[model samples]
Target: MPRSRGTNGTDMNTELGIVVAGVSTIYGRAVVRWAAAEAHARHAELRLVTAQPAAAVPDRYLPNDVATAHRAAAVRLLADLAGEMATGWPGVIVTTDLATGPPAAVLRAAAEEADLLVVGADDASPFTEAISGSVPGDLLTTSPCPLAVVPRREWTASTALPASAPVVVALDESTISHAALAYGYAAAARTGRPLTVVRCVTAGSFDQAAATAQARLLIAFGELYPDVAVSTEVEPGDPRHVLVAASRRAALLVLGSRGRGRLASSLFGSVSRDLIRRSGCPVVIARTQPAPVALCS
Candidate 1:
């Protein structure tokens, strides 16, 4: 993707990027639309993917007719969706893929060359329910790129975000939170939206010193994106609760896949998974592998 400068000198990815979206149920169509707008905003390509699970039996043991039927159905579905997205989102190049594998495996593979991978919220669609009950959780740890899970809701054909809606990012003591912060800053700058950086401490207590230290991490990004009106908050509550509340007024919520404490060694942190489920807006799990940036201890 080509890079360009934002309105106030914040660098941004401008063109030739790829955004992959999983398509299945009716609600999944909404996911594609949301992704299409994002692709349009970046002047990128939209790749729609639909996966058909491999037969439980070995290929030789399975009936050839059944395999052919599955492939045929997947192809038709993708074709129809591609057509719909083309009409709904003009100017953005749209492509389709039919893969044979588990949903997570298929999406992870598709994300290899994508800048963003989008899926519907769990239980929002049949495909989402089939992905171990949580598509975001399944892909959070393994997606090679950023994963965006959009909730099933009515949205317009345009950006779908109110012009004044702010981009919100939740931070923690984990290194991965830095990736989320950077993603949030870039998103805000790219769209000319305000940013709210939040740090949620444990309930019943507030760590002013810790909060101040975490707030310092934003200094460099703020300088880089001076045009992005930014605000900071250190709230006392459950991280999920605080973020979910913040999400109600946000256009997007950004978080990291892994965080600190007991959830440190887990594949995906509990707070991230919970927010992905309950957030009012789309939740983007920032890339596990990030580009070089200013780091704070």
Candidate 2:
């Protein structure tokens, strides 16, 4: 079950909800900064969540005091940074909350009402890699909102594109891919950037049939955003690799979260995960909502 809602309904505001976890790590700090900047721009409130488990407490009470103090120090560090950032971005209100269970599970539950959830890609401890393993994977699979996994070393502080940066959308011959393209086109129009639609066909599969489908998708994309300049490409390689490579040069990688699923409980298909893990640019994972059809008299 999802987390219960708050009575004031402010907790349910999708636009204002963002779950930023793992603030003790460098990657988490990057995510927090980026998310706070975005929240300020969008007039959204930020929620910072940290986790500390009792299992880490030493059996001896004296050592346990030291452990608890360390955890408190880490939390205080994050709170201080968030406070400083909040001062610069007054529109972004930051709240700090602590959870007692697994970090990922706690953060995932909070993501239910969020428009976006941000977390660190790695941490500092030796077991950091192991601890972070399932959190990102599970969140990518089940997060109710879009998830942004910030790499330890980011290219820039802002993921938002420049005024002229092209918006890239990965399109395959699937319903989800088509919806992703539509969302990308709409976003391009909204941001006043040229739209680029990329279709990745396997090297051997790049033939006339694939070309025809690519052309049709391109035409459809153009029709959706007639005012925006649009370009299309049919690359040859693994779709995930091609999309990730292309995303490096593009402003935003717009993609769909739900794809054709052959397995159970697969929130994001294999291709999506690969791109999310490896893409150099910030990715925008659109929810699988049905796009509204154009009405004509």
Candidate 3:
């Protein structure tokens, strides 16, 4: 990915960071539109990427022209999407990259320079491909930055979220959870939305000390983002259930990625998979150093 340049030809990076979106499928188109709106809101550069499957070596059944045509189509798609974003979002620095490779490879390469990678997933569908291998699932494990998995929904005038929708972040006694909290607070502050920090415990047990500790962690972020209205919710139920319910009215649901080992840290555990599959809004997996988390397990 090329770096953005200032008027004096100096290289500069956007504070919100570079946003990469895959734009090859119907779901991907929605993802790009959502990402464009987000990049515009945050004054970030948006890179629209699409990939053409690399040609197989020593193929006798397929002709070269077919591959050429496929590449042509991919080019057209990227150009059209770039044009749409330019028309819709005038000031956003939009760029397009059409790479020759698998869908996952192209997007992951683009994510190397991205602060957040936005992709589309069907909420009603189970992530069977997550285990079997798919783009969003692959990128979820490989993306160096936070991954925003937006559910396919009937968007209102290409608006990703309503004007006043709250940003919800699930928290626990973990450093990664603090990162998630910070991510949520920054998002809320950027969009002028309220913030909700949720902690879930078992049905019959509640630890006031832990709750207090979690609440205390919010003070730093609150001071940093004094304008955002912050609230806390301690719910008695499964973490997935509580967070999904909270997502019903939220603009975005932020969760920390936690586990041990390289593979475990990258993999989305059951709670995150369930939230991504069933949540009422877009679910963002905030990437940070791995840590054990009761809320995210």
| lDDT per residue as tens, model 2, 1-297 | 233332223454354445454455455666677677656655666777666644654546557777678678768876776776677667566766666666666676767767666665445632133234543455655666666655555545444556566778776543335446665777577657788888666534445654565466557667767898987787766776788788777766776656222211132355655565676766666556554443110
Flag regions of model 3 displaced more than 4 Å: 4-16, 55-61, 123-137, 156-162, 173-176, 203-213, 258-268, 289-297
Order of quality (lDDT): 1, 3, 2
> Where is model 1 more than 4 Å wrong at Cα?
1-15, 57-69, 124-126, 130-137, 173-176, 203-213, 258-268, 289-297
Runs off by more than 4 Å, candidate 2: 1-22, 53-64, 122-136, 159-162, 182-192, 203-229, 259-268, 271-273, 295-297
Q: Estimate each model's TM-score.
A: 0.81, 0.73, 0.81
lDDT of 3 by residue, 159-218 (tens): 556776799988643233655776788888877888888766665445566556556657
Clashing pairs in 2: none
The positional error of residue 53 in candidate 1, measured at the CA in angstroms, is 0.1
- Give the Cα lDDT of each candidate: 0.72, 0.60, 0.68
In model 1, residue pairs whose N, Cα or C atoms come closer than 3 Å (at least 3 residues apart or on different chains), thus clashing, are none
Better of 1 and 3 by lDDT: 1
